[model samples]
Target: SGALTRVKTRFYHSGVLSHCVRVLSLSPSRLRGIWASAATLAHLTSSCCVGAEPGSRSEAFHRLFLPSVVDVLLSLAGQLMSRSEAPPLLRTVMDAVGWLLSAHPHLTAQVLSSAHYEQIQMSDDVTRSETHHTTSCLPEDFLSQLNDESALLLLNDAVAQLALSSDAAVGGASIRLMSDSQRSFDVSAGLDSLLEKDWRGRGFEQEVDQLIAMPRPFRLSRRRRRSHS
Candidate 1:
């Protein structure tokens, strides 16, 4: 009775809860008290359910929340893939992936690519910060997390699209927009230096040594400067 009431209430509201629940169902995490509610939502997203459309209110809400949800799902897929566990959850996760690719084809590539690189970059940062006693200039892992393969493809295609549309300036403009935040990404620049060194083919043994020898840049705040005098 209470469960059906919850489902009915969600039906009149948002679709995100339902989709997330579908994810949780396949998840090994054993979420408590919400499974029934989630199943109710998934029931609605099904083909037999009424009123699902690309530009409808429900779809808008899906777009708003779905990206973040997909990020979680991608992370789940990576974890499952890593562990070689192709359970029922994999099918559900694949369903979510298909939905993402179909509904947001333009964004799908970028999102996945960003997720992959973000994970690698974050693990690298954690190792660097803890082991080397360094401060990272990167924002919390969320900002650069958008650099995934799908997003990169979308970006590259977008560049092509811009050229096709005869708007080459858009690509340069995007780069300019990023340069607006240059100071904050200096650590990324430092990492770029290290990576490029390895690509030159003679620095295998000395890559880490060179990285270790590099100076960490210090940022001077106005308040710190004021305190000194």
Candidate 2:
């Protein structure tokens, strides 16, 4: 029965793998459940990639499936950013992103690219309100002003938040992800500029400098086993 269950599980995962990208188009109410399940599946598959030897079935599957999974994950992350009540979901997605980046360093550039950043536009009325003082600008007006440069800044901010999170797993994973991505893309200048003004205030200036200066290779840390009381 256990062997049968494992076979069935593989079939089920393969069945849904092809539809992972399409799942991103579902309505938010529907997507909330689907994204969670899909993300879990993706994370499991990522482990296969890490463990498989070169030129093996697992490696092939990982190479083919991971890019689409990353695309969907990035889309989900962008969607989550627009909602105030989606922090839990956002954190889950970010965790998945970090995991994938650690397992596949090549994915770093795609995940952190501005092309993946969601473009949010403001209405004409909001744009016209720019004449108002910066202090008086409404939140919508402020969001409307986020161009490509500002969008990159926001992306960096999200990464920094996760890198500095209270959760040790999240913080470690995010730092690894950011460092790998920076090394792969050589984005130090741009990323440094984005964090310059607030890095000192945020207390990660030295850490960021070190990460950019010398990126460590990706390694999956073993989970600590819990002892029974």
Candidate 3:
């Protein structure tokens, strides 16, 4: 009776509960009650449409549930990238994405390439700050507004900044995340050089050395002060 009531309640309110449960699932083992609740919610969601005839009901279930599931999964990923650095949770989120990729490759790609995902990756503050400002335009539209040379220069600048970061944790994590995103999206252009072991070796120290070694340009001034007679 209790179990059926729980299932009925979860099934009826699957949308918000799914996300809540998914987030709760990321919690540590000491929170076993929360973990169990998440597991129960997952089971309820999975079983909600069972025994439905192969027709409109099943299709409707998919149409309603799939998007919500994708949203929750992507939200988990964003959380992992922005909020949490716990290795266990990170591994769990990675595994979830990997599994989702196998089952829904296109959807996974869409989620990964979403402007929201990019925003989360670009700045932790955007994720953390409630009042964070973001443009209404799509990431593609924003990028499209940049000319080819501007786009290339922007990309180069981002890469250089990440590669040359003075903080080891920040630089390493940013580069790894970028490389992972590129690999996931099947793009391997500029990342090859970045992924090299010696990349960080050519960071701030090297830039400083080059700057110090370069000679300053001398400019000849044309105007001369008139001599007093």
Candidate 4:
């Protein structure tokens, strides 16, 4: 009886769904298997219905895929965050987070709102650990350019863009570094000094003089009256 067999399969799937929810809810570590199972199911279902006509069943299958896909993406994000070599792979992870965010708002909100704070804090701890092991870590070229104020401004701008645009993959340590850099902003000190040197007798000087010659808004009323005859 084809109808009887279909009814049995439906009951089996329903039972599996209940078990999956229980596992996902109770144990955080249990999430690793969730992605594997969800992926397998999606693959199987997609293959089975490839030739089936478009109808209610296809719509239901797609609706079910949404939550399962979100779960897998979120779990993967958390797993990557815990890895030791995050820096070397940071760009790759950021791209993944951006991709996930575009497709899954619920997952994006969960990561961006609550999970990101802890993720960043842990990354800061890792960076600090690395710094303690080395006396002088930066390259010689970086050290040489460090004294040039313009170079520092350029470096700050580059890091700032990475911090603002990067998603879950960028982690907390990278963001903390950016924040620390922002707090240390001193245009008068580093790159600012270089800009001042280059701009000494250039158009910058002429622009400054022009600005000085310009009347203040308060003086505009008097200038208007004088010009009116």
Candidate 5:
């Protein structure tokens, strides 16, 4: 059943590969989503690229997915100039992509040929250390607050229900609360409590309702330094 195992491994690799791409797409912008996906990407990447049997499985990915990996990461590297600590997963994700790219004799020109190449080239490139001084900043807990998918989902549903409430009085109050809360997300305190109850084991919607009951409940947002900047 090794062949069958390899088939399943390839299938697994394909899905994880897609996840890394999505994270890259959202990076330096969707910092929280980047937060959510970083640990997941690292785990999945280690399993697929580093832990897998080295011969056929690796070769298949190198031939099929490596070029796409290079192109996508080229995009991510380009975007980091403006978003400080924007991607907590940048190192892990890049290691995975870097490992795959290393197997090649040389890097590919696929990015040069891709439509995003020009824009990527023109973007102000940034190093991680240089990212901190750029006037933009991410909340220190950006990764801790969004460490998992269920948490992100709950936050999204919480925002949606608050912003789009159907009850006239409650909707008005919720929107007003959201308007004030949108200035910053202090829900980091509530997140641990929110995530403590297993929405996966119980009802996710039920938990959303519970979260809706909390006063001053807020939407997840990137912090903008509007005061001095």
Candidate 6:
């Protein structure tokens, strides 16, 4: 029998966080990787967290996956915020981002307010209405929708009071957020109120299930779950 790979519990190894960044740069099919990584990231940042500084993990995430996917997620955020419904995959991404930002708070600015973020500018106001178009005219929606990175930054500055809400796993397809008694990758910020009900599509469940279906204990292994943190 092949040797089992030990999953790292305390800290991520050299390539883990960077790997997530690479996967995110691929097609939407790679969403599962993002989900798994997000969950692990959350778990690592929890009280039983990586042996790092008070909040350096935020920079780690910024340097790893945020740069690659922030453009897409932020742009996607505009469209989702305007509509009454959202794709499950997109919702998962937002959930994951909120998890990370809520955990670090500092990452919220590093990501949602970056110079690159300023350049993309996902919006619906008359100024950006030409290209992005106004998804909704509801003053609240327009107001809450951060076109220039203001929406999420409020959380970092304690200006925005985002209630810590969570959605039950959409499908039994993704990786569990927690590996032990602590928790998987939860940040407590409820981003669900913004997006409507979940779509029927699978979250990160199927991949995990597929893996689980394979050889039981042998297929699973452990290590210090390396990270960019």
- Candidate 3 lDDT over 110-191, as tens digits, reads 5444554455545543231211111111132333344334333333433554544434544543343333221112223444
- Model 3 RMSD vs true structure: 16.1
TM-score of each: 0.33, 0.45, 0.35, 0.27, 0.34, 0.32
lDDT of 5 by residue, 59-173 (tens): 6666665565566655554554345654544444444443443334233234323444344323333342221111112232222433234233323333433333333333233
> Candidate 3, residue 103: CA error in Å?
1.4
Candidate 3, residue 68: how far the Cα is off, in Å: 1.5
lDDT, candidate 2, 64-145, per-residue tens = 6667767776666566555554455555555666555555655554554525432211212222121111112113233234
Better of 1 and 5 by lDDT: 5
Ranking by lDDT: 2, 5, 3, 1, 4, 6
Worst 10 residues of 1 by lDDT: 128-137
- Scored by TM-score, the top model is 2
Ranking by TM-score: 2, 3, 5, 1, 6, 4
Better-scoring candidate (TM-score), 3 or 4: 3
- Candidate 6 yields a Cα-based lDDT of 0.33
Whole-model lDDT for model 2 versus the true structure? Answer: 0.45
Best by lDDT: 2
lDDT of 5 at 190: 48
Error of 3 at 112 (Å): 1.5
Write down the lDDT of every candidate, Cα atoms only: 0.38, 0.45, 0.39, 0.36, 0.42, 0.33
TM-score quality measure for candidate 5:
0.34
Residue lDDT tens for model 6, 39-135:
3333333222222332445565446534444444444433333333334433444554454444344344555455433332333222222211111
> Cα RMSD (Å) between model 4 and the true structure?
17.1
